[model samples]
Structure formats: structure tokens, C-alpha cells
Target: MSTELTSREVCQHLRDAALGVRPLQVIGTGTGQVSVDIEGWRLQLEFDGKHLHHCGHCCCPDGREWALDSRQRFGTDPVSLLSTWELAQIEGLLRRAE
Candidate 1:
């Protein structure tokens, strides 16, 4: 027999895995999801139906960061400011938060 997991269970699992890591400060539409913006990396978590989608973006210096989307105008991109290893660490934390 197979047992399904509840939302609470999933959340707990995520929380447990994310211990000691900084939480993502998500800002977006009406969704109980989370995202993180550190250095120049943008990591977003989207919930579709019962599944979760993880998306990430790192902006490089120059005008590229400013030309990607309208949101770029609001603040600087984290990618452009962080090194490759730093970006990877942030991404890892974001993934654990899921």
C-alpha cells in the first residue's frame, strides 16, 4: 500500500531540510510560495496544482541585468554581484527551502 503526503508534511520536511539557512523573502502574486534575492540571483518557488516548480536566474553585469524584465528596474540583480560559488550556495539554500 502507498500513502500520500499532506501539505503540512511537505512543509515540515522542507523546514527541516532548511534549518540554519536564511529564509527566502518572497514577493509576488497571491501564492503561498517563497523566493529569494541575494547578490544577483533570483530564485522563485511556484506552486502549480499539487506540485512545486523551482526557477532561478542569475544576472551578469553590464546592461543585461537591466534589460531582462521590468522588475530589474526596481533593484539590482544579485547574480551580477556574486561569484559562481556564492551563487551556487544561494541556489542550494533555496532548493533546500523547497
Candidate 2:
């Protein structure tokens, strides 16, 4: 079964990967995006400043993925998309575009 994770869990998992705190860890970061690979998931997230822009995830590297946004409020928003920084503890990890 697929698992649903909190923002804090996402942030911590990424942090651990970046710090090489785990045996199986792969991570990459670019201008406004970060990619991570977990045992059964691949996650890519984009951010504008401290706000999330987009999120993509799939069970397999070459499989289908889903898109979701946590920063904008429009029609047909996914449930529980807004993830607060307070809960994530990633204030310093995310930065504004220069």
C-alpha cells in the first residue's frame, strides 16, 4: 500500500538524504527544485521562496506521477495540500529567488 507522509516527514527524509544519513539515499537540487528517491517512491518538489510550487511523485522511476500544489488556492484542489513551514521546520532550507 502507498503511504501518505506529512511535510515534516518529507523535509526530514530529504534532509537525511542530503546529509548521507541513510544507506540508500539519492538526492539532487537545482534552481527551484529538489529530487529524492526512496525505497518505493520518487519525489520531486519545486518551490518559490518558502512556498511550495509543485510536487510530483511516483512509485517507480519511469512510472506515472501525480501533480499537486500547496501554495495556490484554485478550483479542485487536492485535500490537505497546504503544508506549513512551522510543521516542516525547513525555514532555512528554502530560500527566496534572487
Top candidate on TM-score is: 2
Which 10 residues in a row give candidate 1 its minimum summed lDDT? 58-67
What is candidate 1's CA lDDT for residue 12? 30
Kindly list the per-residue Cα lDDT of model 2 for residues 1-98, writing each as its tens digit.
44444444444454553344632233666777766465545666665456545455433433544555466455322213334533243323444112
Off by over 4 Å in 2: 1-26, 57-64, 68-87, 90-98
lDDT of 2: 0.46
Residues 1-98 of candidate 1: C-alpha lDDT, one tens digit per residue: 32432233333323433443434443443364555443333344444434334332322222132122444432233233444454455447644545
- Which pairs of residues collide in model 1? 39-78, 40-77, 40-78, 40-79, 41-78, 41-79
- Please give the TM-score that candidate 1 achieves against the real structure: 0.30
What local distance difference test score does each model get? 0.38, 0.46
Each model's backbone clash number? 6, 0
